[model samples]
Target: MLVKTFRGAFVCTALGLALGVLYGGWTALGVVAILAVLEISLSFDNAVVNAGVLKKMNAFWQRIFLTAGVLIAVFGMRLAFPVVIVAITARLNPYDAVHLALTDKDRYQQLVTDAHPAIAAFGGMFLLMIFLDFIFEERDVQWLRRIEQPLARLGKVDMLSVCIALVVLLVTSFTFATHAHQEGGVHADKGQTVLVAGIAGLITYMIVGGLSGFFEDRLDDEEEREQEAEEAAARTGRSRSAVVLAGRAAFFMFLYLEVLDASFSFDGVIGAFAITNDIVLMALGLGIGAVYVRSLTVYLVRQGTLDDYVYLEHGAHYAIGALAVILMVTIQYEINEVITGLVGVVLIGWSFWSSVRRNQALTAAEPDSEAAARVSVP
Candidate 1:
């Protein structure tokens, strides 16, 4: 289990060490260790949600996530993403941005930091939608039943989650604007930035989510899919409809996962600045942590942990809601990263323990002792 679950983690640690050794020797290694821990703590909820999405994907796409997807997650999102943000915000070309990262590290960090409002708006809104969607879903088992059931009922309203997200955003923007005005500050630009970034996030969620849901609907009718598969087998001597639809579903699912991962990374990237502006060191450490998260995701998927611990997803969505609120709050006042991490950890841990208790009750109530013994402890 260790080898299977943690192969990616091992590879990432080795690579992190090599990168540290080449960059700053033993001191760099220590920095790498710190950053990795920071990322893992910040993004544990992300791993749980990732597993939920990954379970829908086919084996080929799953492998791609572990391989090519890792490159994209680490290099594309962690390293290049910061550079690209700096480039766009600072109005410098990508090459110049790289030079700035290496040479004028302070300037690069400041550029990224300055762009935090928009980034926060976009990421916070996107993640907020994830939580709202989950809470609004009709589920058989409820982790926070009293809170969730009402929200699920509220979900019947058209575009309810979007409406709620927009309302929260507008309220926050006004608070920021009012605070800015009292301090003799400008309001139009800040409010506009918030609105625009939020709309962009909403559009992104719509597009990716729409495509994913479309494919999912197509693949969900088991009878229809099997019949189509059989018809294709008889006519073309190849049962391809189910396979094709399933692959299409997995493709959209993969895209959604990557975008979701990016949204979750926004706060982490910004928080890393609090530690160091050395982009390479930050990437090395965070990259290692990301690999472990991905490994944990795979472990959850393969072990069917989500099925066993039904409320795990509930915990993750709750954490996401908290993170979204924290992101928006950071737009006005500085929030401690430790506080943010602790809230998510606490929510998830509590939910996990809740799941354990529920499992114990169900196991005890089972008529067959052998059947109870067969149940896995997630």
Candidate 2:
């Protein structure tokens, strides 16, 4: 099962390494390997979150995710997106941006770094909304009951997540973002830039997430109607099932997933400069890591890992929340990518351990409960 799931990842890793060696010998190979590990560490929680969404998608859409979605992730987000950012921020044309990336790698990296505030704000808010919406929504399996219960109760208030997110944006825009600009001697209104970018992130999330939910709800309604019809036919000696996701619903869900991936990749793209300024190497390395992440998502869905370890999703979201906080902090201060990666690993590890303990307790109680039932019968 593992081999079947991860076959593509292994192939991609070999190709990426070979390209690395051809590009710059052993040193580039090492950098490529480090960048690949960096992406995996930064995005392990992304696989968990993605599994939750991908499981809902149909098989055809899943294939699209692995195929076209991978192209978009690798070239669009990892490569083209940075070029676009540099183009816009540095006021260069797309060709010039690409030229700059190819020839003047250091200048390209600095331009990308200069764009970090807006990028961080946008990605940070988008991820924060994801974390907020997850925590605020009520779920049957509560990982941290004491905290989640209260938040879920408050979630009954409409748009509570949006409200809280707006407040956070406002506070940070005026405080951290503003302070950073003043301290750095940047002449522009950094606070305004952060505010606009944050709002854009918030609105992007609302529109994409909202439309996806709307289409998904429509699909659910269709499924319910079809199930009723199937039941009626069953009474008349027939059985039928319908595809739940199709047409508009599947498209929107695909869009949602792509947007989510872009948001998750923002930090990793910026952090990659810390390792190396070679755009080709970064794309190769991070692309390989993304393949593995997608494979892991498939593995989780096929194996029912999320169903078995209920708290794993919760842990992933908490890690996302931590990352959101880290991104926001990074607007004013530098954060080591190692710290970001470790934070996610620790949270996910803790959740996995907790899930194991819960499963063991449940298993141990089963025989005792059966014995007690037998005693009562006697």
Candidate 3:
């Protein structure tokens, strides 16, 4: 299993280097490594979000995510998508975008900047949906029932969200739209297109985010049942059926992992534009991020880290929610990617540390009990 886990990542890294050598030589390798680390850093929140969702999927989907999903993420979205965007928006010939990225390193960065607005819109809305759903959706622990109850009730219809989106669009169109047009004048027409595209992306995010929630709820139900069966089996001293059921739950968790992986990769692909636009660099960098993310997910599952860090999961969901709002607003605001990433990393990192602190406190409290037990042990 360990060998299989690393196999695809190794192949991708090797292939990226081979192509880099043919295309741009050793400089390309340096670029790839730098971009990979950047992407990985920018996407730490993605790992946290993936862990929360992955606990609910089956194993088959997880394998597909590590294999095919990585390709789509690293290649289609990270590389080709930007080139395509540049071709359409920059009025550059599609071949020119490709050629520029390969031969003229200086110009490739220009095309990437030109490509950012549209992709940024997509990513912003995508993340917004993630945040909204996680916040509003019902969860097993009603710890924050005071806040969650109202949101969950409202989210049931999603009418409020729709209304809020409409208000945003209307306000943006009337206010920002006029301002943007006044500044750009003749190019004002394009502003409308950009606005429409942003809305479309937001709608798409809502659909995907809702689907993720639906699937997650179902998986949670399955987990509860499996847990009940395991408890019953333990009481009866029946091992075989309980073990089989545990295997089934594990498979579900793997599937959940894959879907979550795909969701987290959305922003990584979008953020890859900050580096070299050479398809090779984008693929290499994003692929490296994928490798570490997959490893992190597996580690979390094997160690049951999420179970230990209850608030860490909560922090990730909060980050996702905040990111979504930022993404939506940035459609017109031109927020920097580094800022977006850092915000999420800080939030999730704080949560993880808090979880660790909590666990430590629990452990410390337990030592006294252990000492008492020793004192009483006959």
Largest lDDT belongs to which candidate?
Answer: 2
Q: Cα miss at 248, model 2 (Å)?
A: 2.6
* Colliding pairs, model 3: 54-256, 54-257, 57-252, 57-255, 57-256, 58-251, 58-255, 128-324, 131-321
Question: How does candidate 3 fare on TM-score?
Answer: 0.72
Query: What tens-digit string does per-residue lDDT give for candidate 2 at 45-72?
Result: 9999999999998788888888899899
Q: Local error of candidate 2 at 113, Å?
A: 0.9
Can you write out model 3's per-residue Cα lDDT over 238-275, one digit (the tens) per residue? 86342234444544444444444444555565566555
Q: What is the C-alpha lDDT profile of model 1 across 1-378, one tens digit per residue?
A: 769779779977998988898999898898888889998999999999999999988778888888878888899888999998888777789999999999998878878877787788899899999999989988899987889889889999999998999899898777763342211122336667777888899899989989999998888886486887798788977645444678788889888989998998888888898888998998899899888888888889999999999889999999999999999888777898999999999999998999999999988877676666778545
Please tell me which model should have the higher TM-score, number 1 or number 3: 1
Q: Tell me the number of clashing residue pairs for each predicted model.
A: 0, 0, 9
Q: Give the worst 10-residue stretch by lDDT in candidate 2.
A: 179-188
Give candidate 2 misplaced runs (Cα > 4 Å): 179-186, 236-245
